[model samples]
Target: MGIEGLVAKGAGTRYVGGRRDWQKIRHRHSREIIVGGVLGPITRPDAVIAGQYDAGGNLIIVGRTGTLSPSQSAQLATLLSPAQAGHSWPDEISAYPWSGRDAARPLTKVEPNVVVEVAVDTATQGRQSRHLMRYLRIRPDLTPADVDQLQL
Candidate 1:
């Protein structure tokens, strides 16, 4: 797993800023760690697992990885709550970069050079349901919008 590779290389911790910088890279490079490219689509028949930490240090576990039983899903949800509970910045990762409550919009823009796939377990629709819980990956090519179109 990417986390294992990062640890092997002596990377003690990773941040969302690392993700932003990786997106700007020309090609996927892994001197010390493997990284985001291995992760697959959220709706792929085969799944990928991933996690992200928001500013407050809340770890959000995401991606299908495989079919999750209800109990497992709940456990995962609990693990990810810190991110949800501690997100004070409305625009840290949201469609509205400035923040005005258009949560349905894509949080990160998928550049042509970078293909990042994001895996999400469920999507809820509502005024408050703006951002989707996602496990992001830097694939060859990917778009957050496609996740919304997945046939469940």
Candidate 2:
């Protein structure tokens, strides 16, 4: 017989809660993006934000890395330097079209010279990824231009 499953729910349930009410699970997808900058304080970064270059060569914000460990944060802090004047994507860090309360948080733009691979689950909306991404690792051998070769 074909596979089967059961979904238990309270009687008269009307979607009155969160994901706990759902019976289905979703899989995540992965991709590589250029590290455009880091968000939060330099001493302890909250997340690593990344982007991809479009056909027009514009560095478009793709997504931000998820919660990083202390060691990861410290290591990133050492590798990244504060973006100086005339930085590429000058307003990108502050002008990110964050939704809800996220817009209120500060973003520290860094040199967009690092490349990283990340695992993301959601679909892309406009130029941004729809979900928070997990940082898989840094691609020391890869350059920002290599992102175009990735299938996504």
Candidate 3:
């Protein structure tokens, strides 16, 4: 199920503030995504804008990574470069669409060739994850073509 998790409640149980009376039991999923674009600079990305190719061979924005650790940033820097002309994605994207925030910022388009791993909850809106994602590591052994394409 594409649900966050299951909650098991005791019969006739009264709600408590912080007693672990009910278990959230969130489901975290690890997935492989293409590095489409990024926040901050090409040399040191603050976060990653992940993507997955739909059945139409079009890249769909999937999710955003939380702030990158210095080590992660450095590792990504070695793999990413400025997207060439006629890139599949735009130069920037509105934050409001995915972030639910008022401020929109510029996104640095990347080559869309790097494949990396990320951790996300089961919360998804359309083709995109609706929650913050954790960047796990670069999958150097895998290519973008090896990433799973969306069913669409």
Each model's C-alpha lDDT? Answer: 0.27, 0.69, 0.88
Reference-based lDDT, residue 101, model 1 = 60
- List the candidates' TM-scores in order: 0.20, 0.73, 0.85
Residue 47 lDDT (model 3): 95
Give the Å shift of residue 130 in candidate 3: 0.7
**Cα deviation of 60, candidate 2, in Å:** 1.1
Off by over 4 Å in 2: 1-19, 88-102, 149-152
lDDT of 3 at 102: 62
1-152 in candidate 3: lDDT tens per residue? Answer: 76698788988997888687886767898989999999999999999999998888888898899899999999999999888887787667777655688677788999999999999888877878877789999999999999998865
Clashing pairs in 2: none
Judged by whole-model lDDT over C-alpha atoms, candidate 2 comes out at: 0.69
lDDT by residue for model 2 (35-88), tens: 777777877887887878776676767777778888888877776777777656
Best by TM-score: 3
